[model samples]
Target: MIWLALILLAPLGAGLAIFASRRAPGALALAGAVVGLVGALGLFAGATGGATVSASLPFLPGFPILLIANPLTATLALLVAGVAAAVLTYALGYMAHDPERVRFFGTMAMFVAAMELLVLAGDWITLLAAWEMIGFASYLLIGFWHRRAGVAGAAMRAFLYTRSADLGLYLAVFVLIGAAGTSEISATLVTTGTPALIAGLLLLVAAMGKSAQVPMQDWLMRAMAGPTPVSALLHSATLVAAGAILMIRAAPMLPPGALLAVGIVGGITTLIAGMMALAERDLKRLLAASTASQYGLMLVALGAGAPVAALLHLIAHAAIKSSLFLGAGIFQHDRDSTALEDLAGAGRARRGIFAGFAVSALALAGLPPMAAWFSKDAILAAALASPAAPWLMPLALLGSLLSGAYMGRALRALWSGTDSQAREPVPFMAAGMGALVAAAVVLGAGFGPLEAMLGAVADPKSWIVPAMGLAVGLGGLALGWSLAPARLLGPLLTPARNGFAIAGGMDALVARPALALAGTCERLEAWLFAAVLSLGRAGLATGEAVRRTDREAIDAAIFALVERIFLMGGRVRRLQSGLIHRELALAVFGIALVIGVLLAAPLYR
Candidate 1:
């Protein structure tokens, strides 16, 4: 419990310290990341074999901020912590010379902390809060270069797009609370109710948005405007992966229809994004599309009731993608260009980088001796085990083929170029790549332990299943290479370039209508206000006329009353005498006059 709290708060605390002591923000961030890393490892070690560690906060009496480490949480916590550490180390080198290094490091730390909290959260409310925090931190990191309009715009789009989906999660939480009488994830999942199913669907919508699947995907492509390190963290480890993690975590509560829906969407996104990666001319954008494609595969795994497979794929992808992004960054920094055409002869100049890029790319393409090969094979096998497995297999195979084709093309473009375009590699950058490549090789070659670790999570007869999947994936790659030179592939290339028009069609169909409706509402509100103002003016004129009439009547009545009062005063003054005796006589006369006035005024009516 203490370790969990430390893990959750360390990065946040470091961010605060960095803010207060801006001179050493990078150092503070590094320290916080180290602490988080230690805590995560401790949690993982303590929670092996499905053990759980939990603690409740006193401040939140009825709904304490809880952190629990089960096999699932431990696995994710380790991944988040490990990647955060690597990224921070890279950031130390990347931001060492920047003027706003403190701000950069601080935001990055906060982002990492939020992801940790997300993985540790035991309840829906806590998870949602962490989810928003991650999104918020991502917005800041993406728009770090605030001076650039493109960066700012991309940041806003990301925020707005994700927030739109977050609303669904908010509603889902409310529904869960109403139905289960608790916000705890465990209780919500165990309690059977119509609202529970509804809440699950709503939460899935939020996951889809955060994951950048289908309609919400354009924001990610735009997000490339941020610093390359930010992209590396986002695409590889943190922001995008959170959605898949959420879905996997909550899989037990998801309705069958919801799962199937998720699978269909995932399959479609994978194919589309893979194709788009093939058509992209920019190196980073190609990687961006590839990230989306890989995430889609994870989603399919989760939807096919294979959380372990999804998670393994996620971890594998993170290692390879991070290295790819970092490599791309180095290439861009050295070459001063991100365009594929301009990168000719880069391989001859930087053989190490080219080799690193190839290894990572093949792993991403699910080639042999890479982690992607094992994890991706598991997903395909799981899909084959499902009712829609037959149809899904072909789609999965096609997506894999597209991924290999594009990644191969990218590799050729990088290495086939002349030696003149490349420069000497940065040591730290090369070290990062080498570490990731080593990890990929280890996981790819020695997947036996990983499979054993999965234990119950692994499907029955998994050995034969996964091996068959690998064969299919490799065959697709071979076929793609053979067909690469043919003009007949043009249509497929166009479709790949457009990512099946999913994001583009979403913008035109859904986003535009919502915007148009908002615009119409604004115009109608203005017209209504103008009409109300004209009516108010007319009402004011009528009120003034009535006021003038009332004022005249009041004036005449006051004047008449004053005149009567003056006459009465003249009669009363005569009764007052100068002397006491005269006054007494006047008093008697006044009493007699009052009696006479009363007798005269007293008519029976």
Candidate 2:
């Protein structure tokens, strides 16, 4: 519990310190990342003993904010911290000369802290809060250079797309909490039947958006407008990973209907995103598409009822993709652009960096002795053994092939051209990327202990899975290295380059409808405003008419009677002027008048 607290607090505190003091931001961020990494290590060690550690803080009534450290959460926490430390180290060189290092490092720390919270959250309440925090933080980080052309728009697109899909998560949580009568995530896993199916599909929607699956994927490519470190972190273990993490966690609660849906969605996304990757000209966008494809494979594993396989793949991908992106960042720095044409020989200029880049690229291609090889094998194996093997196995294999193709193409492009003339020392950046590349190289062998710690068994070792994996991976590499994307994609090239939009993609499906609804609401509000104004005017007119009636009719009659009485009083005063004789005559007149009134009253009755 204390370790978990350290993991969340260290980065958070560092971020605050960076902003408050505005001094040595890099050192502060690095310190926080290292401390958080240590805390994750400790937490993993504690969890390996099979005792789950958890702490609860009062949040919602009857549902506390829970933070738990188990094998799964601990492993993820370790990945997050590890990747964060590496990325921040790289950013030390990457953003060293920037004027707003304080803001950059502070936001980076905040992003790390939010991810830590997300990994540790044990209930819907806590998870939802963390989920929202990451989205907000990513928005700021993605649009970090808001003044840059299209940067702010890219961030906004990412935000709006994910937020729209986030509605599914909100609804899913409602269903789960209602069905389970608790906010506890583990408790909600027991929910079955319609509720579970509904929640599973809804969760998949949120996952798709965050993970950059299929139609919602264009935003990720646009997100390359941000900094390289932002791209690396966003694509690898933080914002993008959040979606897949959600699916993997919720795998147990999904029913067959939902599982099939997940598998189908993953399959489609894998194929589409892979094609997009192949067709992409920009290095970062290509990698962004690759991230989606890899996550789609994870989804395939989950859909096959093999979450451990997915988890392993996810762990492997975090290191693999981050290293690839950092390498691309190096090339970008070399050429001052991420365009493939611009970066054609950027890697060649720095052989050491090229070596690191090639290693990760091969790893991403699922070559043997690389971390992704084992995980990719696990995914293929799980797909092969699945009930939907006929449908899933092909998708998984093709996705694997596409991964190799794009990576091979990138490597060939980087290596084939003449070396760039300019050179710059990037000790910090090299060190950071080297650490991740090393992890990518050696992480394959650690899955055994990881599996043991989680107490989850992967698919039985099979020769066919590895054989197919190798065949596609090697074949795809050869094809990509030899042929151009035009020859490969052929007639499909246009759509692939356009992100393979289906019925105009999410813009038509979600954005247009939302905008139209907003427009309709605006029009409706205008009408309501006009109607209310008219009603108010009518009320004012009615009030005026009533005031007129009171003043002109009722008050006028009363004033007329008062005027006649004043005239009668003046005549009576003139009559009283005579004295005694006049007084007797007045008394007789009053008596006669009273007698006359009494007689008239009797007659009228």
Candidate 3:
């Protein structure tokens, strides 16, 4: 458990050192990787000696983050640590001239450390937390060159797809936990029936999005826009591998229905992605498509009831594919492009690197003595022996054949071009690629023992299996070498080149809907703005009307009444007499008028 903590923290600390300090980031990154690598090896040693270690720290009231050392987690930890160390080492050479080593290596370290936590997670809560961390780290690493055009978009697309699928993971974890009353991954394996089925299928959805399976696969090829080390890391053992890892971990609890669903999805994705690879013209994009296809094969293995087979392939592919990508990075450095046309004869120029690349390619094609050949045969054996052999076997074979075809095409193209383009070898880069190529060459023989460690046995007596795999692999290579892709792919040629768009790809699913929503929002915003302006105008008019009414009505009436009062006062002043004679005459007139009125009143009565 202490080792696990160190393994997870080493890269994390290195990442902080890279970002937070002004010193040389390469050394810091390398140190972190070395520490993590040593810790993983120690964990592996402990596991082999029949020791298990687990640690739990409080997270929720009852649910906690669980980290454990077991055969599966330890092996994966070693692989992730080793690959991350190698990629970071290679990046030391690759990014020597680039100015952003701090940012690049920092994110790389963070990404690697996150993967360690993911692999060593003993409970769903830890897994879910680590799952999100990986997505964030990948986003940062993939968009490390944010100044580059289209890079931000590529990063966003990758993030959106995976983040959306992450919903399934959230749902699945709670589902299993609800059913089993525990968040511990090992304990949740006891969850069966409908609950398991629902969780398993939900988990598959998450896997598909992360692994670049089918419709979600479009983002992966575009992810090639990132730096090559990013490509190598993302494809090899970190982000893309997470989905398949989840599937393998949860394989025990999946119901047959969910398994069949996973298998069928895998089979379909393998064929289609292979077609895309065969049609790809960019070296990195070709590798990206192949990554999707390879994971598809792993899914098929899981579908065929062989998680061990899938695990073996996963390990083998981590080495082989990273080597291939590293070699491509060297080519990209040489030609300043990954396009097939630009890379023509790149192999001829960099013979040593090309040799390593070719070895890994052959290994990917499942040739004998190579890592994938051993793993691929195990997957084939699993598929062929499964009850669903009719679908599984053929899909696996088609994927295998296509793998050779595209790889052979790449090799021939590289070897045929001029050697005018030469690149100076970077020792660190060479060392990194060399390590992986060696793994690609020798890891095949280790799978049987890996299975033994896990107590799973594989079929060994199927002689026909190896013979068929070799023939198909060699045959695909021959055809690809001799033929043009235009002829080989035929109708698939155009569609695959256009990214196999379904109903106009993003134009239909994303762009059009997004545009419509934007337009609606714009119109709504405009209307609201207009309505606000009209209200302001109305208020001004109302205030003016009130002012005018006060002046014209109330003020005018008061002033007119004041004028009448003044006129009445003047008339009364004129009627007033100031002489004594005027007062006597008025009194006599009043007496006469009173006598006349009294007589008239008596007659009326």
Each prediction's total of clashing residue pairs, residues at least 3 apart in sequence or on different chains, is: 4, 0, 1
Residue 260 shift from truth in candidate 3, angstroms: 0.9
RMSD to native for every prediction? 7.7, 6.6, 6.1
lDDT of each: 0.78, 0.92, 0.90
The order of the candidates by lDDT, greatest first, is: 2, 3, 1
Question: lDDT tens string, model 2, 1-605?
Answer: 77987899999999999999999999999999999999999998888898799999997689999998888999999999999999999999999999989999999999999999998889999999999999999999999999998899788788889999999999999999999999999999999999999999999999999999876988899889889999999999999999999998898899999988898788888889999999989999999999999999999999888888899999999999999999999998888888888788777799999999989988888999888999989988888888999999999999999998998889888888888676879999999999999999999999988888888875468788788888898988988889899999999999999998878888787767777888899999999999999999999999999999999999999999999999999988898797898889989999999999988997876
lDDT minimum window of 10 residues, candidate 2: 453-462
Span of 10 residues, lowest total lDDT, candidate 3: 506-515
Kindly report which residue stretches of model 1 are placed more than 4 angstroms away from their true locations once superposed.
Answer: 59-61, 420-425, 444-457, 460-468, 475-489, 502-504, 509-605
Native-vs-model 2 lDDT?
A: 0.92
Candidate 3 C-alpha lDDT tens digits along 87-161: 888988998888887888888888888899999999998998899999998888788888899999788778877
Which should have the higher lDDT, number 1 or number 3?
A: 3
The C-alpha TM-scores of every prediction are 0.81, 0.86, 0.86
